[model samples]
Target: MLDMLTRWYQRRFSDPHAVSLVAILLGGFLTIYFFGNLIAPLLVAIVLAYLLEWPVMQLTRLGLPRTLSVMGVLLIFAGLMVMAIFGLVPTIWHQVGNLIADVPNMFNGLQNYVSSLPERYPDFVQPHQVSTFMITLREKVLGMGESVVKGSLASLVSLATLAVYLILVPLLVFFLLKDKEEMLEMLSGLLPKNRRLTSKVGAEMNQQISNYIRGKVTEIFIVGIVSYITFAVMDLRYAVLLGVLVGFSVLIPYIGAAAVTLPVAMVGLFQWGISPEFWWLLVAYGIIQALDGNVLVPILFSEAVNLHPVAIIVAVLVFGGMWGFWGVFFAIPLATLVKAVWNALPATEPPPEEQVEE
Candidate 1:
């Protein structure tokens, strides 16, 4: 049976191809089946490993042992996690409580706005009523309401999974940090090469991943600081809460930070009215993003990583479908790793490194 199996496989695809196909299908199926329970935490672990590797490498250069270095990384990580939870939980909970308390006020505002809209257009029907000419419109609005409720429920489920991720992240991160080198070595051995090529690719990918991760975290911290200072100075309500959210969202590529600011600013405008405070948020965020784009990002993330904007969108779409927010959050990092692997292929590599463009 073994001889026959070998003959059939050897006559068809290469051994590597056969093994890789099996690995891909099996791993993919398992990931799909256990995504909520397992895959997410594993991805977080990988990303955390990326973030910590630089400090670990730096520690080794400073003459610390690998084990000690890894421990230091874990310590810093734990300290930050504790500090963030302490700082953020109260602010977020406070903001959330305020929102809950203001629900009636918000509904009043919505009702007032809708009333005003009809007056601005006299031909417009009452927002909540149905007349001979507006029955279809009323039905459509009701359907819209149902869709909104469904969307809200979906969002709640996603949020609950995020809570689960918070629980899993640290545990996974600890193990990943401790077993980083061993994992890399074991995975590298499975690569179909004379070992040297695999080792080089592995090392290059590690460096790229580590650099990207550290740079991104530093960027987030800087953005957060800039936002907090601005919001505090501007005297916006829930400024700290919104600022921290903006800072973290900014870690996502392109649209993340800017996307959240619109709604946040609108809330400020609505609540605070069109005063200096109302407009200050827009100006502050605009300036912060400008500075980040022109100075901070270029200085900090010099290598650029060469990911296409189109690639980023596709990744967000694909992974967002599979894993929702997490897929969106970690899409860029996952895409980066996938890109590195794709680029490493002999058929995919541009002639040679030296021959490639500067």
Candidate 2:
């Protein structure tokens, strides 16, 4: 067993570049795992810088100085963020308040409907079974409601931290965008000199992650705006809130869409009660999802990483469990990084005797 382990280690880490790459990767994983909360603003800034870099490059190519380009992009980005915070957030919060106020009515209606299922289908749904299911569901729902209240209170306590992130993130983003090359040079200087494999993986991940972040942000807006417009036109209550949920649902791949469906359906059911309007709303909503999956995703992600569905789902589950929202958001890119590193590893050749036998 010892000999076998030694052979495996030599086969994997024989190259100096491989050792360097492994060391760098291990260090990064350890830092993030240990000090993620401490450096969260830095991470957020890095991601925003990546998202904003494209526009800065565009302006620079159009004869603007790099400093001027960074300023222009940063100003526009900050303005949009301010508008979202001041204008959009309050509306969503109000809608959320309205939804919470209506929850008791909705729950009562649902309980009544479920209770009637036994009478409507005596053979399929027994009264005792319905009673037990209702009891379990009510408990689960009450638990969730209590959790939400606690979360809200916790968020209130963290407002100061949020303000700090808001301030520090933009400043960090500005310096990052302005001193991009210098930062790269400094980081490169710190890494081992024998890092050809690491450089290759870094270059690939740079393009891959940039495209993924920008494309994902664009997808979120497009879906959110379209959903909001559709819900408003159909006179659906809590349109903005639901639209936002549907938009962000793209982050979780298959699971998000499935999960958000319940709220949308419940709201519609309580409002229209199996009427034509409700059916039409559902049909329109379904079309949006279908188009997003079949159309928008392919177009946006054409130049992005091409991961299999199972691989994508596994990445979502594993990384999401590790890093929560950020993990789920960057799961595909992280998985792609792993794949790139593996592919770049030097392949060991068999002995001449084995080659001759073959």
Please tell me which predicted candidate would have the highest lDDT against the true structure: 2
TM-score of 1: 0.70
lDDT of 1 by residue, 84-113 (tens): 899889988898677556645654565565
lDDT against the true structure, each candidate: 0.69, 0.90
Q: Candidate 2 — worst ten consecutive residues by lDDT sum?
A: 349-358
What's the CA error at residue 78 for candidate 2, in Å? 1.3
- Whole-structure CA lDDT of model 2: 0.90
* Candidate 1 displacement at residue 117 in angstroms: 3.6
TM-score winner = 2
Give all TM-scores, in the order shown: 0.70, 0.94
